[model samples]
Target: MDVFEVVADDVRRDLLLALRRGALTAGELARTRSDVSRPAVSRHLRVLREAGVVQSVVDGRRRVYSLRPDALAPLATFLAALTPPAPPVPARALDGLDLEVRRTTRERRTAHGAAQQEESA
Candidate 1:
């Protein structure tokens, strides 16, 4: 299953959110969801595990689940490529303009009512 496909379900997404805090056994994950039964939650977890978004580790008799964040790398990379980068600042945008210096000089002259000596280059 595509990583995106597995996450399309709300339950699977919520399971991922819960797992983000830390690992939890299947029973614990199921308890966190009041709407879904344990069996249903297990199915959702199965999908997530198959999709590579979650991983399970057997601790004695308990099966612990945790999010596999690296699994989202492909999705993130796709999104970053989909969005265009900001246009680069034009190199010569203000090349010939000394408007800032001129404005400051004018403001100083007006506010002080006296000509200010220009700074030496």
Candidate 2:
């Protein structure tokens, strides 16, 4: 599924926004948003991890999560390319998409490297 579909949930958006500020533990994230339960937050985190939108590292007993930053680039690039130039979609919006794709591409590469390491280990 595309990053848009994966991030369609409100909970996921909140988590992503939080990560944008900096990395946080699951419990910290749960405390940041009361609309979603702690368990629900965990589930959402899992989904984001699977989508390569977030990365988590074990910090003692907690898993500290942060935005992947460039994980959504492939989707963003695909969408940007599909946008019709003659449709007046706004150059500003297209520029934003271009930036997003560049960022996501970096995250995608990092995630791939991590996955490869996991497989080797």
Candidate 3:
């Protein structure tokens, strides 16, 4: 099974999340959740191991499991590509309107000053 297929199950995903903190024995992983049986957790662990999503080491009688982060690189890259880019800044339409209004006011003031000077003369 590939990494996607292996992590498709919620129980298996939970098991992976538990292993992310550190290595844990099969029993320890099973105990992390109360809903699933130990055997079921073991089956999920087997799938994860088969997919290269996790690696196991025999520590005495127990099999300790830990996450293999490198195995998830492809999935991470795929997800990153799917994420939408940030929205662009909006155009300042009001700024141009404000400049036009100021120009019109300045023009009217200058015209009024010229008319007053002509009347006085």
Candidate 4:
């Protein structure tokens, strides 16, 4: 479907990793694993190509599949945006400081009022 969905598949992810080393022909890719048939590998490559995660070009008579580095741009951007900024002082921490200041101000005001009442008496 998309780049993330395409790479979410184990087969497709493996294919991309393999291509990272160098471009590999479909047959070569199939031969690398015993469980996967050549046709299956080809199908996975087709999906990757559609997602733009992989690209293929004719080399001699064979089509070699390679990773498209640009295709990973979306993922990189998404991850970068998600990274949290450096932690600054928290609101709760500031709230304690504010409370202390308010308490001291109230005490000062009450003490001043009491002194005035004493002087009047």
Q: What's the number of clashes in each of the models?
A: 0, 2, 0, 0
Clashing pairs in 3: none
How high is the lDDT of residue 79 in model 2?
85
User: For candidate 2, lDDT tens digit of each residue in 21-115?
Assistant: 99999999998789778999999999999888999999999999999879988767888999877766778889989999999999999999999
Rank by TM-score, highest first: 3, 1, 4, 2
Best-matching candidate per TM-score: 3
- Candidate 2 residue runs with Cα over 4 Å from true position: 78-121
Q: What is the TM-score of each predicted model, taking all chains together? A: 0.66, 0.62, 0.70, 0.63
| Models, CA RMSD each | 7.7, 18.9, 11.9, 13.4
Pairs with backbone N, CA or C atoms under 3 Å apart (clashes), candidate 1: none
| Lowest summed lDDT window (length 10), candidate 4 | 28-37
Report, for every candidate in turn, its global Cα lDDT versus the true structure: 0.88, 0.89, 0.91, 0.87
lDDT of 1 by residue, 4-99 (tens): 788778998889989999999999999889899999999998999998999999999989999999998888888899999999978577754667
| Global fold similarity of model 3 (TM-score) | 0.70
Candidate 3 per-residue lDDT over residues 1-121, each given as its tens digit:
8877877789988998998899999999999879999988888889999989999999999999999999999889889999999787566857898899999999999999999999999
Q: After superposition, how far is residue 53 of candidate 1 from its true place, in Å?
A: 1.3
Clashes of 1: 0
37 in model 4: Cα distance from truth in Å? 1.1
Encode model 4's per-residue lDDT on 2-121: one tens digit a residue.
Answer: 877887888877787888899999888777765888889889889988888888999999999888989989887888899998889889889989999999999999999999999999
TM-score of predicted structure 4: 0.63
Q: Mark the 10 consecutive residues where model 1 has the least summed lDDT.
A: 112-121
Candidate 3 error regions (>4 Å): 87-121
